[model samples]
Target chain A: MAYQRKRICRFCEAGVQYIDYRDEKRVSRFLTERGKIIPRRVSGTCAKHQRMLSSAIKRARILSLLPFVSDNPA
Target chain B: MSELRNYEVTFIAEPNFDDERVNSLVGKYTEFIEKNGGTVEKVERMGKKRLAYAIEKRQYGYYIYTEVKMPGEAVAPLKRWFALSEDVFRHLAVRMTDRDVRLKAVTTEHYRKEMDRRNAATRPGAREGGFREGGREFREGGRPERRDD
Candidate 1:
């Protein structure tokens, strides 16, 4: 059987407007323990949003809203 | 010429500014990098999110990330720029080796999956009464419910 392809951007759901990095609860979902932004291919985020998401994650790290590295074990 | 290194610099802007102003500020940084003979690999705009803690009494901020390939000396000028910008609340510059770049790509994949798992766990009905072991509940009012049970 052929595999089904999934839509790239999950946040395309109507009414989802912006990526917020300060919300570790929300941003943590997009970052690895080492503090890297998960890519679109793996996160299924569309290219545009993934780019946005990565930027947000990076900002959060600098502000100490998120850690540069994960302290908790995965 | 000294070897070029990959560096990721991220910064948070005060949440109250209009989007246009934020973009302009970010553009300034891009321009600075280009003027310094650095190649900007990417620029990302992460939207507003709540701060982990209050910053200058503000609860949230706008975030921006930029990746650049430049000589090690460029970091000093970049740091100076960040220090001078009132809009920037915090910033960091991390040098990346070839190994670090490769590992970052792989780790990013793992991060995505982990996020998916958390999202799945949060969907309505994923758990009874929206509570999970060791997890706090966030009420619709935006306050977290303490797990007293």
Candidate 2:
């Protein structure tokens, strides 16, 4: 049998009960350089936390904490 | 009358608002909440912050976050007030559930512990041959290795 490592949800591991939209710094890490939300498969986020994260990102965008689209790719 | 509920209201004002102006603005909203059968619980002036994108061609905005307790009926009128007010550039009101309240109360200690655990786990050659650091190196070249074997 081949050995495989399990991926744990970072949010769950961190005991994050609420993902605050105001926390743009932490949320931005889950986004690609182009400002698109990274999918769960790529980011290893659980389904529930991914839903919360996406909504939080959307809310942050509305509040101008996160950009809807990046002007510069960098 | 409906029972009072917790709501979080956040608004952005023009970046040029001075401390005095911001305080007066907070006072104004506090009175507004009281008049609308609500009580203001907390107010935070987040100061001027650079916007992620231009809003009204402005690069910055002053943020105000407030927690209020009010009946559901009062929300509509408050939103209307925001819409009509020249001072408010943008506003959002979110109703808070018990879950939200519980989550908000989670302390920083939990986060610190998690970070420490992750740091320890990620130490060089700790486990799995430190695959995470190498994983990114592989990703930069091409898609990450996905084979289980």
Candidate 3:
């Protein structure tokens, strides 16, 4: 039987940039109810972008474009 | 005299604070910048969003962005302030040179264009059934082959 290997993530292979914290729209997608970015496993982001994404997300949180938590419970 | 440089500082605040409390924290940092001879060009409030992972066990946080022009020496004091503030969860201070400013503008423009394209593609009655098939596949199977070159 021929071996089938799992594919790597393109964002990891091609080095597609992850969203920066300053880029509000991009970071918004990954956030959870409390306005936090979901982890790599959930977000499916590559490691490098994940690092940068986290930093940016943290920055955005500090700046307040995103809420600390959803004002209205979902 | 030291050359004036633009700096962008972004930080995360504790989640669940009212607007007033969040603003007060932002104000404190802005004041620190001004007191140290830094000119604040912009102060943006990026509301709450989910963390990529749990941070201090919090699932979300408020975000703030500040653009200032100041001497290099002022950064240390600002860092110290951030360290002492419990409300601030994380912070970063980056010096923005002329090249950086230009690059930023270009990137912002590019992002804007991309956003427009995506929006148009998603509009109702437009290109029905042309949804990005690869994204779903990649999300489910962690496959790279479906990504565009």
List RMSD in Å for every model shown.
14.8, 8.5, 8.8
* Residue-by-residue lDDT tens digits, candidate 1, A1-74: 56657654666542233554544676687777666677776667877667657776776665768766655635
Write model 2 residue lDDT over A1-74, tens digit each, in one string. 56545577888866687887888898899988889999887778899899989988998999999889997975
- lDDT string for model 3 (B1-149, tens) is 37679988878888788899987887788788889988889988877867644677988878777888999988899899998999988777887778767756776676676566456445532445645652343242343333453
Q: Write the per-residue lDDT of candidate 3 for residues A10-60, one digit (tens) a residue.
A: 345543443455666756777886665687766567777777677777666
**Tens digits of lDDT, candidate 1, B18-126:** 8799878978888998788788899888868676556678788887877899888888988998889888977777676787567556655655765664564466435
DockQ each: 0.13, 0.47, 0.14
| Candidate models: Cα lDDT each | 0.70, 0.83, 0.70
Error of 1 at B82 (Å): 0.8
Candidate 2 global CA lDDT score: 0.83
How do the candidates score on chain B by TM-score? 0.70, 0.73, 0.74
The digit string of per-residue lDDT tens for model 2 on B26-121 reads 888999999989999998888899998899899999999999999999999999988888888898898889788778668355667646644654
Q: Docking quality tier of candidate 2?
A: acceptable
